[model samples]
Target: MNETNDMAVARAARLDTATLSDALDRLGIVGQCHKIKGRDPEFRMAGRAFTLLCGPASTPPGTVGDFIDDVPPGAVIVIDNGGREDATIWGDILTEIAHRRGIAGTVIDGINRDVHLCRTLGYPVFSKDHWMRTGKDRVQVERTECVVNIGGARVAPGDLMRGDPDGVVVIPRAHEEAVLAAAEEIHAAEEHIREACRGGMRLDEARRQFKYHQLQTRQ
Candidate 1:
C-alpha cells in the first residue's frame, strides 16, 4: 500500500474500538472484546489489512523474534492462545521487537506479561488477561498459517483488524472496502442522531428523522 494510503487508513482507524464496534454493529457484527482488561492502554496501532493469527503456546523461545521480524510493517498480529489464561504468549520482548519493526498492535486471546513494559514502550496489546508465568512451558505454536480462533471468530492471516480501548474487530479481506464504507456511513449517521438527541429531540424522533431503523436492515 502507498504510504499516503496507509496513513489515511491509520487516521480513519484512530476512532476508538467502541466507534468501530458501532460501525461493525451497523454492518451486522457483534461479540468482540479485548480479551484483556485494566492494563494500561497502548494505542499506537492503526491499519486495515493483513492480520496475524498466532496459536497458543506457539512461539518457542527464539521463534517469536523471527515472527516479529517476518511480519510486514502495518500488519496486525492477532494471537490466539485458545483462551488459555494461565500463560502469556506476548510480553515485553515481543512488544519491543514488534514496535521496532513497525508491526501493528497485537491481539492475544489468552494472557500477556510485561504489562508495564508494553505501556512504557507504547505498544498496543489486547488479550484475555495477564499472568506472571511465561508461555514457554504451557504454550507452543502449532502453526502460524492456520486459522486461529479468537473470541469465537476464526481469524485468518491477511484479514483486517481494527482495535482500540473498547475491543477488536476482524474484517475479512474480500469485504474490506465495503465494510469500511458502511462503517463510515454508520458513524456519520450516528453523529447526526446524537446531535439531534442533544437538541431536545426524543430518541424515537431522532431515530425516525435520521433513518436509524436503516441500521437494522441487513446488507
Candidate 2:
C-alpha cells in the first residue's frame, strides 16, 4: 500500500531534528534548517509542507496571504522571507486561526511577532527570531506552493517538516523514505549505546560497540 501523509507524519514525530539532521548528513542531503528555533522550548510538530515565498515590499508592504483556508489540516506552513530580521511575517491572528484549523505548525526563514499568543495556544512556530515590527509594509507575500528556503535549507511543497526544541529539519518528498530509515537506524543505535552505558558499561565502550562514531558518516 502507498504510504499516506498521516503515516509519514506519524513516523517523523517519532524522531527529533537532531537525528534527522544526522540522517540527512549521512545521505548527503542538506535538509537541516540552520539558526531557526521554536517560539517556545516545549513546542514540537510534524507534517507535510505548504510553502510560501515572501520578499521586501515595493510600493506598499504586503499583507498576509489568504491561503490559510486552502492549507490542509496537519500541514506545516513554510514561509521564506529571505531571513529578514526587521519584519515579522506571522503573528497572533494567524496563530489563532492555525491552531483552530489543526494546522501542524509553521516555520519561517525570518521572524515572527505576537509570540505570546503562540505560547498560549501551544502552536509550534520555528523561526530565526521574533520581533514587533509588522511585515505589512516591510515585506510581501510573493507566491504560494513554491519551493522556498527556510533558514539555510530548501523547502519544497509537500515536503515533510519535523521540528522540536532543538530545531527543524525538512525531508524532501523524494528522499523521505531513505531519510526516515536512516534516522531510525541512527536513533536506535544511539538508544542502544545509552542502554549499554546505563548497564555499567563504559561510555566509550558502548559507543564503540554500536559503532556510534560511524553512524552519521556519509556512505
TM for every model, in the order presented, reads 0.81, 0.96
Once superposed on the true structure, which residue ranges of model 1 sit more than 4 Å away at CA? 2-8, 11-14, 22-38, 41-44, 48-65, 213-217
The sequence of per-residue lDDT tens digits that candidate 2 reaches over residues 38-88 is 989999999999999999887755567577898988899999999999989
- How many steric clashes between backbone atoms does each model show? 8, 2
Name the 10 consecutive residues with the lowest summed lDDT in model 2: 1-10
Error of 2 at 162 (Å): 0.5
Point out the worst 10-residue segment of candidate 1 by lDDT. 56-65
Among residues 3 or more apart in sequence or in different chains, the pairs in candidate 2 whose N, CA or C atoms overlap within 3 Å are 61-136, 61-137
True lDDT of residue 140, candidate 1 = 63
- Candidate 2: residue 45 lDDT (0-100): 98
lDDT per residue (tens digit) for residues 52-84 in model 1: 444444334333334667678877777777788
Number of the predicted model whose TM-score against the real structure is largest: 2
Native-to-model Cα distance after best TM-score fit, residue 187 in candidate 1, in Å: 0.7
lDDT of 2: 0.92
